[model samples]
Target: MKSSYLRASAALACAVVLTACGGDDGQLLLSGTISGVTKPGMILTNNGGSDFEVPVPANGTGLTRFIFPNRISSDDKYDVRVKSTPTNVQECKLFQNTGRAGFDVTTIEIVCTFKTQALGGTVSNLKNDLILVNGSDRVIVPAGATAFTMARVAQDAPYGVSILANPAGQSCTVANGVGTMGPADVNNVTVTCAP
Candidate 1:
């Protein structure tokens, strides 16, 4: 009886050890590559849990590994995203938003760019000349003009245009004239004037 009890105890201990070491359940390693970031660190969140401020790779073009504080279950849903981006840089976007932890994931990639486009619009019912201001830059739309354009505006740049003065006794206002620039040119800005 004593020998049998000792054997049972040994088997139980082995099972406990294996369970503690993630036996039968495969380990999940999460990693990915990032580009267009030259900062020291960025925040990454897993499954919407607490934010993990991981250090950005010094090379600015390499894989970034993330080690979860606790062991995550296999086949669990993982939604990794950029909690915050580096300052003074183009926004970074994630390609794959959702993934399953069936195996180690390493194909995720992040890309960033600083390209921008122009913003312009048409002027309707203009009985007088007026000036359109976007920041320090201004464009003068003469009477009987149909359109105006602001070139080389930065992406995601906010523009608000107002009529400096309308000499044609026309009250002028902006319509669809307030917004941030997107990836494409903004040509729908409308400045309508009424005499």
Candidate 2:
């Protein structure tokens, strides 16, 4: 009878170990989509956890879905966010910045826009007035003015400078003008005037 009781106790211990090693039932998945990623390998995080790098498709291919690495429990709170942006030449913004992981949520989106740069520069050898033209906006630099600045110019936008009213018998010529603005500030644009 003692041997039979020992065997039953061992069987009970083995059952308890198997139950302890079973998979958890509380794990939930999280996923979403991303747009405006020109380059590949964007990263995302969960409540400051480890980053999950996103895969980029080949050229001419469309973007792919982003999924988290580990499953989260229902009791844990998650704030999904971008860990790092794409290495492309665009500026990305995230919609639905923060959300809770109560269930399997997958409605997050990221949109990106072409980054803008400043268009500005100094005026030198100016003996007459001139106007810098960007779209329909214009800025007049006085005859004796030595410097000028234009800000918030859109990327890849065309710009030019011309003599609005040259009354000082001086002809103005632009050195670094009449070109599409790049990703950085165009501060080297010089308008030189001479008699």
Candidate 3:
């Protein structure tokens, strides 16, 4: 009787362990920003490929993002498209050309250029931009501003903040008096001037 009870307990323990590791419903965490000179409200579409659409975030800075709960698939490739309401040329160009999704973050960084605004102006530009870097260990210089911003949706996860320099592909200077992520805990930022 004692032997049978011990075997049953061991089996139950094994079953619990397997159950914890056997769920295929794992979630894929998607986080990134999209910017352009287009209107404040632009809709980013997955175009029936997958279930995702990130509208351009308000704040008139052209920064937008979304998080999808579905698991990412390696076998499938999505034809993601960004659709503007009336269609702005700059926004279309920025999203259509720079927009992409993948499992690798480094490749994403290499292929993507962060969006920035025109120097000394309140306009959106994507031509000359830089990848927004989380400056925890290294100092990231902005094209214009003294400090940049870092935004996050998840708790305690390492959030990556970004910005694009001159959207025209010109090396411009960042505006002064701008603030960046402070210390190791700043989760969101908003800059009045370009960087």
Candidate 4:
């Protein structure tokens, strides 16, 4: 038991030291959106794959906002997943709102948009923006467009989380909205498109 206690103490001490030293880059906030077109409700995990829940906001709309330690080391990359599936063969989508200003997406707008070409079909521009993910081949609609509600996953992102994606041309963008925390309160975070 004593050995276990000592190990735990040492681990915590390391975390603190890392947190402090990581702040040098200044405060950077990570923000973005997660969509649930295949499922309803979302879950945030620290692991790059899947497993575990990070902190979330009070009211969820696929939108979320939170602070990250000054340094977003390899350990900070978090995976955001959701269970917002469609009822039938119809298309579905959900969004995650990372509550950081000037970040990837202030709010993510997801939707069914009917079917297009890939993954059985795709969701087209219900709004106006040009964002197409999943196996679908359609442009993302802008906010306030028809079928916009179906596009969001959460109001904000889960706390202490981040993601990345591939296909350089295909990148995630911060929708648009106000952030909650003050700039100084956060730091050194990255929000990349995830696979």
Candidate 5:
């Protein structure tokens, strides 16, 4: 009878311990929302670990969200940051990315901006007022001007520079003036005028 009582007592003790250590690990998932992601290659990190890349949405929604693979415990300090930005984007900034992991934090925001490059080149023998144009954008180069710049163009965009109006008493032509705008400024265009 005493052995049976001790066995029952041991079972009760095991139940109590199991109840105390429940299934609640208390880890929370971390995620964020993103917008203006024009190109792929956006990589994110959490506490300098758990690196992951946020791909550009193929559904054409522009990547409305993302999630981290790692989880954090309640009240644990967390730091999330962008490791790299997409191509054609100047930078990606994170908002509300740092805080204590008290709950499932999903309000983090990421915004990105496109990179722009200036379209300019050297001009020689420009003795009279001249008008240059790239699409609707125009630039009026005064007499004796050695160089000119159109308007800034977004990276990976197409640009075709041409002469809107030639100078009086002179005929000028543009060389290497038609191409796409790269990541750097274009300054190789040459314009030579003949009398």
Candidate 6:
């Protein structure tokens, strides 16, 4: 009994000291910084392993950093990348997130930016300064102008370009002005300000 107790204690000591033990040995932490990660639904992966869903702050959200729950073995290769992003997020890119795990992994940064696209089209006829509006955004078209472009709209957002004011003695109507902005610019809107 005494000999077995000594052996068990020695094994326990070795495990605690992490010398030749199997539990929690030769592991390294993985973490990094984040910015512009609004909304949610952002998934990250390490060496194509388990998924790491980024947390979104509710009030006064400052989700600027993350520490992955899973740890990688030291000297093992770690390839961290963004698997997906929220609908509003245009793109989420990872920097300095791929390398061999060491005693101290370098700082990784994931930055995300929103999506936006230009909104504009063409106008015809001899018209005075005309006013146009898309939601809250408005544009003034001078007389004899061939083309016009309103303020940029958020990608996939609704846009309704209408004639706010027409030139004197002339009526104008816009066609194909009500729709959702897609991935590319909208240049098909036609404004006809004439008799």
Between candidates 2 and 4, the TM-score winner: 2
The per-model lDDT (C-alpha) reads 0.71, 0.69, 0.38, 0.33, 0.84, 0.81
lDDT of 1 by residue, 114-172 (tens): 45777888988887778888878778888888999865676555677666676467788
* Candidates, ranked, lDDT: 5, 6, 1, 2, 3, 4
**Candidate 3: tens digits of C-alpha lDDT, residues 39-92:** 333444443544344544457554445444454433224344555432332224
| Candidate number that wins on lDDT, 4 or 5 | 5
Query: Root-mean-square deviation of each candidate, in angstroms?
Result: 10.3, 7.2, 17.6, 21.7, 5.3, 5.2
Error of 4 at 67 (Å): 9.4
lDDT of 4 by residue, 16-130 (tens): 7766644333333433443323223333332334432324344544333433323223324333333333331134454552223333322433343322211111222323243
Predicted candidate 5 versus true structure: per-residue lDDT over 35-137, tens digit per residue: 8775778889988886788878877656668888667767767789998887788877889999998789999999877789988888888889999999999
Q: Which segments of model 2 are wrong by more than 4 Å?
A: 1-41, 48-50, 54-77, 86-97, 101-104, 109-118, 125-128, 134-138, 153-171, 178-186
Candidate 3 ranges beyond 4 A from true positions: 1-26, 37-41, 50-53, 69-71, 85-91, 94-195
Task: Work out candidate 1's RMSD over C-alphas.
Answer: 10.3
TM-score for predicted model 5 compared with the true structure: 0.63
Model 1 spans > 4 angstroms off: 1-113
Residue 50 CA displacement from its true place in model 6, Å: 4.1
* TM-score of each model, in listed order: 0.43, 0.50, 0.30, 0.21, 0.63, 0.60
Best by lDDT: 5
**TM-score, candidate number 1:** 0.43
